[model samples]
Target: MMYKMQFPKIVLIIIITSTLAVNEIRFYPVEAIPDIKKVPEEYPTIQAAINAASPGDTIIVTHGTYNENLLVNKSISIIGENPATTIIDGGQRGNAINVVSSGVVISGFTIQNGTGGLPYSGISVSGCNFVVINNTVLRENYYGLQLTNSNNSQIFNNVIMNNMYAGIYIHDRCSNNAFFENTIKNNIVGVWSSNSPSNVFYHNNFINNTNQLQAFPPMILDNGSEGNYWSDCIGSDIDLDGVGDAPFAGDRYPLMGMFVNFTLRYGSQIYFLSIICNSTISNFHFDRSNGKISFDVLGSKDTVGFCRMASPLTIIKNYTVYINDKVPIYIGNWTVSNYIYGYFLYLHESEPQRVTVMLDLPKNENPQSLFPILVATLLIVTALTIIILIKRKGKLDKNLS
Candidate 1:
């Protein structure tokens, strides 16, 4: 009888442990803030919507042509409905859009017709830590996008063409800004900077521009990966490694093609193959044509690692993982499912490492299946708790008799 009572209590502990282990594995999804205001629906003009919006609010503009300059003084997202159909015409005024506050995001619009000079721009950002992406800044009287005294900003995926001066101008000691994947074409100068140190440029295509780059002080043109592509880079890839031989003096690894892809696998289940370098990981996808999954990575001489904690649904008995076609040094114990698996890698000759997982499974484990298992374990724990309490009460009544 004593053994029978102890059996229920032991079962209760096991069920509780299983339930806790399953609940501990969590995936962090990037949260999207809902749009609080819409232009022409909530307010008549774009500037009016901005005036009525509070900080962290998103103001989405519909597809139409609006002839007015915008001044953003708060942290908000001014998103256009479509990049081609949505237009913000400055009408030869000072600037198309001037951002004076930080943490602003301007995307999906065609900003044009600015008449102002040096300090004035199509999109002038005096604020730090902003994002200007997925826009077309064309026919500017001065600079297309100017960054003055701004630090830690990102300017990416924009088509900056037909500008009279530089496509992008960084000045006044602006540091740690990243310019990537932009098409700076048909401008007088692609990128011109003065006194701006530690700015990074990568993967941009400078096509048909009169001058490529003009700098007063030296900047980090490349981060040891393939730098921006120049139309006049007369270099040739003899070994066909997708890196140029030597047309531009400063660009050590000039890309032979427009883009490059890498492969990564997460412990038995997740795989990101043919992915672009330095991208973000959002999902486990196999097809790159669908363009659904990516990872945020960097390539350099320093060592780096990729880590993921195994969920309770995954059984980690004997796992084989590869990084850059080489086996990784596994550093943690894997007796249970809630263990962390990590692969430490050292860069070899300025290239990103590839990671792959080798799994010989009868069927792939589903991460979603853990929920039902957790529910069943919770029910078992509740049932065993009642059994243990009844057994103790019977023993007490026998002692009293």
Candidate 2:
């Protein structure tokens, strides 16, 4: 670590002030220099856009039904205008979108109608790394997602249901892949993995499936803090921490409630964290200015509500929980994963209650919470000095006369 005395005072102050400045979150979007290719507007088809686009370009598909099987061979981002109306049907043919390139991001689309077979899916990946598939819908396909020899990929925030075979099929030594925050419902099998080892699965809801897993590989069902929520889980949360006691299949710490994920952007970096709550969590706010992460939790008056938080280690090193502006009697914490895990319970009412997580960053790095107080003290000192100077000048004028 570098010493602070070696740096200038003004530079350090600027860094701290701007790092957690009020109302500055999500302001500086990284505007890349890549060419943006619009579908049907610039190329008339998505395939045409890919054919003409260079690597690192972005293809934006507007709101409409597009009947085409896309094969992406270059590193690019394909974003739909909206997942509900941006439909990409494969006409009962091959895969809806086959990705042979790494660093690919496909989001906000409803991909369906692929041929009913293994390796043919709404989104198929082969030998790719750093690929992200999120904010999309995959239904009525042979496999909602198929990953072959893919590693370091993230699959989250997608409604993948009613598939013919499995919602996700992974094989051929797929390792280090993360599957989280997805709703895999009404499928023949939720996930089928063979010859794939060391793949992590968490924060996904497995509901109403004939078979949840038909596996031949070693998988981590939990992130050491909490696991995915299974509708048919036999385990129970005895300690009221929103985590199950016994193991369900392979998840030792299954979440009692559905996992909710939030994407927060500060400056150029994006931060991701998840919450497992019995209440309807909304109005989530991350105020680094005051070192408080606040949110509104709502539920019926008859039910008791609780929220389990999985805070990223990069965001805050420690935190305190406050419910409705009062500190609760008990708050549970887990020393499991690299991230900070904590939870608290509250009595539900007609109005939504506010919960806040007062953050404590690492030593000397978090220059927040005290900055405002220091500014106020500086203003007071300046005002007192001005008043004394004015009185002294008046007395000096009288003495001169």
Structural similarity to truth (TM-score) of each candidate:
0.62, 0.70
Root mean square deviation (Cα) for candidate 1: 12.0
Maximum-lDDT candidate: 2
| Candidate 2: tens digits of C-alpha lDDT, residues 342-365 | 878778889988898887754544
Steric clashes per prediction: 8, 0
Model 1 Cα lDDT, one tens digit per residue, 70-146: 99999898999988888898877788888899988998888887665434578888856755555554556478888
Question: What are the clashing pairs of model 2?
Answer: none
lDDT of 2 at 147: 96
lDDT of each: 0.67, 0.84
lDDT of 1: 0.67
TM-score of model number 2: 0.70
